[model samples]
Target: MSLTQRSSGLVQRKTATVQSVGADGGVEERDDEGYTPDEEEDHDSKETRLTLMEEILLLGLKDREGYTSFWNDCISSGLRGCILIELALRGRLELEKAGMRRRSLLNRKVLLKSSNPTGDVLLDETLKHIKETEPPETVQSWIEYLSGETWNPHKQKYQLRNVRERLAKNLVEKGLCTSEKQNFLLFDMATRPLTDGGIKQKLFEKVQESVLSRWTNNPQKMDKRMLSLIYLAHASDVLENAFAPLSYDDYEVAMKRVQELLGLEFDAESLKEGANELMWAVIAAFSK
Candidate 1:
C-alpha cells in the first residue's frame, strides 16, 4: 500500500475501540461507530473547555512560592490546555513549544499581530543568498562527501556522506534551523581572512563620511541637526576613551592614527575639518 494509505490505516487502528460486557452488565462490544456506548458517554462527559472561574482559579494557584500538587493535578486534568487555547484565541498567549514543554512567562505580555509576508520573503531570499555565497571550498567538499559511495535501500545506490545530508534532513524535518545555527554562521564568517579590525575601522569611517555628507546636504530642523551632531560627538568620545590614554600633546598623533585607519588622504584645512567631524560624531554617538 502507499504511504498515505498506510498512515490512514495506522490512524484507524490507533483510534479504534472494542467493547465487551462482563456478567455484571458492562459494555461488551463496540457499536458500528467504533466506540463503545460507555466510551462515547465518557467522551461526551469529558470537559473539552475551561470556564472563566477555572481560569481565575488557575491564575490564583500560581503564587510566589510556586504551585502545589493540587494545582498541578487540576492542570494535568486538561483545564490548562483549554485555558491556553482560549488565551491564544484572545491574543493573550505567546505560544512557544520547546520539545512539548512550556517556558516561563515572567513579565510577559501578549499582543495580536499578523505574520509579515514581506519578512518571510526576505528571509527566504537571505537564506538562499547564504547558501549560494557560502565559501565555494565548503560547498565543494560537502558535495564530494555526498556523492561518495554509500549504502542505502531507499535512495540512490551510490551515496556520499557528509554533514549536509544531516543538515538537509534536519531542515526538511524541523522546518528551519534554530538561532544557534545563525550564531554559528556569524562566528564562522567573522573568522574569515577578509575581515579584520582595520577593515571594520575603514568601513565605519566610510559610513560616517557618507552620513556626514547627508547631514550637510539635507537641511534638517535645528533640533534634528543638533541632535545628530551631539550623537556623533558622543560616539567619538567613546572611541577615544577606549584607546590607550594619551597626553593632551599626543592629540595630533591620535588623530593621525584615526586618519590612517580610515584611509583618509588629508590636505591641510580639509584634514582639520574631517578630524573635527569625526570627533564630534563619535562624541555624539557615545556620550550621554
Candidate 2:
C-alpha cells in the first residue's frame, strides 16, 4: 500500500472513543473523530516532512500533559547531537582529520567548513557557535557543551536555551500540537498537546517496526534518518515510550536488538566516511 493509504488506515483505527457520565450517573459512549478538519489538512501537509529534531521532541513529549517525561534528562543533549548529525549530512560540518588519532573523541575536533545559512534558526546558531569558538573542540566536547554539561558552571553556555519550549512552539506551528492554557488552582500553565494523533502514531509505528523487525538482524540496512532516530531516542531513554504498548516478550526482544546495535563498533575505514563519522559520533556520545 502507498504511505498515504497506510496513514489513513492508521488514523481511522486510532480514532478515540470518548466516555462520559450521563445525567443518570451511568456512562455513555461517544465516538469522536480523532482530528478536526484543519488538523486533517495540516496532517496531510506535515505527514512526511518532520525533521529529526522535531521527531525526537515529539517522542519525548507527553501526549496529554504537553511536556516531556521526567526521566528523559538526556533529550537536551540528544537533540544537540541530532543537530550535529543533520549539519554533517548537509555538508556543513566535519571532523578534523588531524584530530582522528583513534584515541578518543575528546582529542578529536569538529570543524565548520561552511556557514551558509541552513535556514533553520537553531542549526544556524549552532554553526555560528562552532565557527566562533577560538580553539576548536572535539565532537564529544561539543556534544556535552551543547548539552550544557560543563565545568565552571558560571561560564558554561551551550544549553540550547529554551529547547523544549522552542520545539513545542515549532510543533504548534506545524499543527501537530495545540497550545492550551490549563489552570492548577493557583496559576495557569501553557502546554502543547498532541492534536494530531495520526502523525504521532505513524512515527511510533515506524520506530517500533525498525527496532523490532526491520533492523533487528541488519541495522546497517536501516535508513540513515531512522538509524539516527533510534540512536537518539535510545540515548534519551524515550525508546520505552514508543514500545510501551508492546507485549512483554516483544519489548524484551526489542531491547535486546537495540543493545546489539549499540554494541556494534565502527572500524577505522567506516569512520572515514562522512555519514558513518556522524553516526559513530552520535553513538559515541550516548555510549559515554
Candidate 3:
C-alpha cells in the first residue's frame, strides 16, 4: 500500500516495528501501531502509541497480581469510553452534525464517517454495530449499550463481550504481558501479567510527567492521546494508582489539576470549529 493509504488510519492500518524503551532508560527499538508511521506528520496518528484502551488497561492491571480490582465497577464503562475515543482518534468515527447551538454534548449522536475495518478486531466490532444501527445512538447511550448495561434486549446485542480479556490477549500478543493461569479460591482462571517491567515503567512515567513536569495547562495544547489517557484513567477508577507513588505535595497538586480537567465545560470545547466532538462527548458522559 502507498504511504497515503497507510496514513489514512484504522482501515488500512497494519502493524509495523517501532520504538519503545529499553531497560537502561534508553531508546529501545521495538514494535507497535498498525495505525500510522510514527515519523508521519498526521495529527491524529502522531499522538497514538498503544491505543487509548490498551494504555488505560495497562495502567489498571497490577504487575504482580495480573488483574484489576474486583470491586471496582467503573472500569467496564471506562473501557467503553476508551473504545469510543479510540475510534474517534483513528478517524473512523465522529459525532453527528451540530446544527443547533442548544444541543447538549450527551445528546449528540455518534455516527460512522467510514465503514472500513480498523485493523483491530475490537474497534471493527464496535464500528460494525454503529454502522448497522438505524438513527444512531447518542454518546451516552452508546456507552451504556457497549457495556451491556442497557435495558433494551435488542440493543443488548451491541455489547462487546469479554472486552477486558480480549484486550489482555492483545497485550499478550504485543509481548508486554505474559499469559498465565492463577487460582482465585473459587476456580482457576487465565491471567495476563506484566512480563516487561520497563514498558510499564515508561508508561507510568509518561502518565506522571503529563501532570507533573510536562503539564500543559491547556488540554488543547497537550498531546491528545495523553489527554485522553488521563480522563480514561480517571473514569476507570485507576487514576489514583498513577499518582499514588508521588510525594504528598505532588499528589495533592496533581489531583487539583485533575479536578480542573474534570470540571471543564465539554460543551464549550465541543462547539469549537474543529474540535473533536466525539471525544468531548465521551468525556461528558463519564463526567456524569
Candidate 4:
C-alpha cells in the first residue's frame, strides 16, 4: 500500500519525492514515477494530511473525553519523538553521519537536511528551533528539549509549547475533531473531541492492518513511518488504546507481533541504507 493510502481516510495523495529545497525554503516535489507538471496541483487538491504526531495523539485521545489518560506521562516525550521522525520523513531533518570512528546513533547529532517548511505549525516551529540552534542536538537530547524536561535553562527554550493542544487544533481544523471548553473545577480548558469517526476509524484500520494483514516480520521490510508509529505509540504507553477493542485472540496475536518488532536490533537497522537513523535513535531513546 502507498504511504498516503496507509494513513489516509477520505482522500489519498500519490507518492512523491522531495528532490530539492527551493530557493524559498519550501520542498520541491518530484513524483517518483517522474515529473508530471499537474501532479503537484493534483496532490494539493486532496485534503490535509495528518502527521505521525497527530495520528498517535488521535489514538491516545478518548473519542468523547477528548483527552488522554491523566497518568500517561510518557506521551509528552513520545510526541516529541514523533515530531522528529515526521520531520525526517518530510526531508526536512536527519542525523549527522557516523563518520570514520563509526559513532553510535545517540552520539550522532540531529541536522536539518532542508529548512523547507512542513506547513504544520508545530513542525514549522520545531524546525525553526533546530535551524536556529548553534550546536546540533542528539536525538535523545532533542526529545527531552522538545518535551521541556531538560534542566538546563537554555535548552528549555527549545520546548514546543502546548503540543497536545496544538495537535488537537490541527485535527479540529481538518474537521476530524471539534474544540470545546471543559471545566476541571479549578479552570476550564479547551478540549478537542473526535468529530469525524470515519477518519479516526480509518486510523484504527491502518494500524491493525500493519500488524495483521500486512505483517512484515522484518523491520527493514516494513514501511518506516508505520513501523515508527507502532514503536512510538508503545513508547507513549498508549498503544493498548488501539488494540483494546480487538478480540481476545487478535489482541494476543497483535501484541505478540509488536513485542517481536521491539526486540529487533536498533543499531543494525540504523546502519541500513535509506534507513532513518534518527527514527531508530528515537526508539532507542524511548526504550531507555
Candidate 5:
C-alpha cells in the first residue's frame, strides 16, 4: 500500500478495532459506546495509584497521620485529594524521568482537580462556615456520605439530596459552584459517565493531540497543581459514559469543579483521556 493508503488503512483498522468491543464483554457490532471489563479493570488500577498519591498529598496537607490513619483516611475521605495529587505526581515524575532538574520540579506545584493554594485553609474556612451557617444534620450527613459511612440499598435518599443541597449551597457561597446554567450543566455532567464516540483511531488522534498540546505547555504558566486538575478532567472526559465533546463552558465548569473538589486550578487542555481502545486498554490503571 502507498504511505497515504497505509495511513488510511491504519486509521480504518483502528476504528474497526474500537467498534468491535462492547460493554458486555462480548464482541458484537458497536451500537452503544462503552468500556469492557478489561478496560474497566485497567482504569481501576490507574485510579488506585492516583488515589494513593492523593492520600499522600492530603496527609502532607494536614501534617497528619504517620502511617495507620493514612490508609484509613484515604479510604474514608472520598478518595478526594489523592486523585489530584496522583495526576500531579505523575506529571512531576514524568518530567523528572525526562531529565528535568529537581529544583525546577520543586518550585512547580502540580495542579490537581480539587486544589486550593491554601487547601487546608479553604477546608477550614468552609467547615467553619458550614458549622455556623448550615444546620448540623446537613453538615453531618454530607460528611457521613462522603466518608462512605452511609449506605442504602435504594440509594440513601435523604443523605444524597441533603448533601447535594448543602454542598451546592456551600460551594455557591464560596463562588465554587454558582447557580448559573453553566454550573447546572456541569453538575449534570459530573453525574454522567463519558461515552461520546467509541474508541476509534480518529477519536484517539483528536484526543491525543488535545492531550499532548495541553500537557507539554510552558510549565511556568501551567503549574503542577493545574496540570493535575486538567488530568482529572481528561480522565473524566474519557469514561465511555462521560465522553461527550464539551463546550468551552462545559470544560470551564468541569475544570472549576475539579479544582474545587480537588483544590487546584487546572488547564483544560492538558491531562485528557485518549482514544476509546487506548482508554479501554488502560482502564485498570485509571480506576480506583
Candidate 6:
C-alpha cells in the first residue's frame, strides 16, 4: 500500500468518533465506547498534526514541567526507533534483505534508498546520518548510536544527550507546547509545557483502551499505530504513565496483556507480507 493509504486509514479511525459535552459538566458519548465527546474532538483535531516521534515525545514529557521524567532513561533511543519506523512507514527506509554471509540478526543493516525529505528537521537529519554512515549498522545499533548511548571511559558509564529538549523545541514550533524560562537559583532553565490537554488525554485513552480492552481481546485486529505506541511506550519505560490512573484490577490485567503481546513472535513469512513489518522490526529491535 502507498504511504498515504496506510497513514490515512489509521488517521481516520483515530478521529472518526465525534463528541459533544452536555450540561452539568458531563461529557456525552458517541458511537465509540469509553471516549467522551470532548476527548473524541481532541483526538480528531490533533491525531494527524503530530508525527509518531512527536507523539512519543509528548507522552514522555511531564506536563507543566517542560521536560521528560529523568527516570525514563530509555526515551531518547526509543524516540529514535520511532523515527526509523515512521520513515519506513513513509517508504523512505527499509531493512536490508538477508544475505548468505551469516550475519547476526542484530547486525542487520537498514538501507536508505530514498533521499525523500520528511520535512521534519530531526527526521531529515537522522535519515541523512543513516544514508551517510559507512559499513551501516543494524536497527538496534542505530537506535543506541543515535540516542548517544556511548561508553564514556572517563566517567565509566554510558552517556546520552539532550534529545528531549530538541524535540520539545520542535513541539513548540508546532504550537503544541509553549516554552518558558525560569531561574534555578544560579541559572535560567527552559521548559516546554503542553498547551493542549485534550489531545494528551485522548492519547492516554487510546493506549488504555488498547491494552485493557483491544489487545487483551483481539490482538490481531489491533491498529498498527496503536501497537507501535504500546511497544514504544514500554521500550521508553514511560508506559506506567499511561497505566497510572487504572484501578488495581485493571492494571494487573493490562500488565498481563502487555506481557503476552511481548512474548509473541511473528513468522518470517508473515513479517515479509504484512504492512506492519516495520512494527515487528521495532519489536525485535527492542526485544534484543
TM-score of each: 0.15, 0.77, 0.84, 0.86, 0.23, 0.74
Task: Score candidate 3 by TM-score against the native.
Answer: 0.84
lDDT of 3 by residue, 1-288 (tens): 000000112111234666656557876443343233432223343333466777777778888888877887888899999999888876689988877577787877899987778678999999999999998889989999999999999899999999999989988887778999998899998888889666666666667777778778987776666777788888888888777777889787788888888888988887765468899899888887
What residue pairs clash in candidate 4, if any at all? none
C-alpha lDDT (0 to 100) for residue 44 of candidate 4: 38
Tens-digit lDDT track of model 5 for 220-260: 24333233323333333221112234555644544443334
Q: What's the lDDT for all of these models? A: 0.25, 0.67, 0.75, 0.77, 0.27, 0.65
TM-score for model 5? 0.23
Error of 2 at 24 (Å): 75
lDDT of 4 at 66: 90
Better of 4 and 6 by TM-score: 4
Clashes of 6: 2
lDDT of 2 by residue, 131-232 (tens): 888688877777878778778574266557887788789889878899989887998878899998877777777777776656547555556667777778
Residue pairs whose backbone atoms clash in candidate 3: none
Worst 10-residue lDDT window, candidate 2: 1-10
Q: Whose lDDT is higher: candidate 1's or candidate 6's?
A: 6
lDDT of 5 at 58: 22
Tens digits of per-residue lDDT for model 6 on 101-177?
Answer: 74444556788868877666777877888787777767776776676664634321222346577778877876668
Error of 3 at 64 (Å): 1.1
Judging by lDDT against the true structure, name the best candidate.
Answer: 4
Q: How many steric clashes between backbone atoms does each model show?
A: 32, 0, 0, 0, 45, 2
Question: Which of the two, 3 or 5, has more TM-score?
Answer: 3
Error of 1 at 77 (Å): 46
Off by over 4 Å in 5: 1-79, 82-122, 125-146, 149-166, 174-212, 217-222, 234-243, 246-288
- Pitting candidate 3 against candidate 5, the one with the higher lDDT is 3
Q: Which pairs of residues collide in model 2? A: none
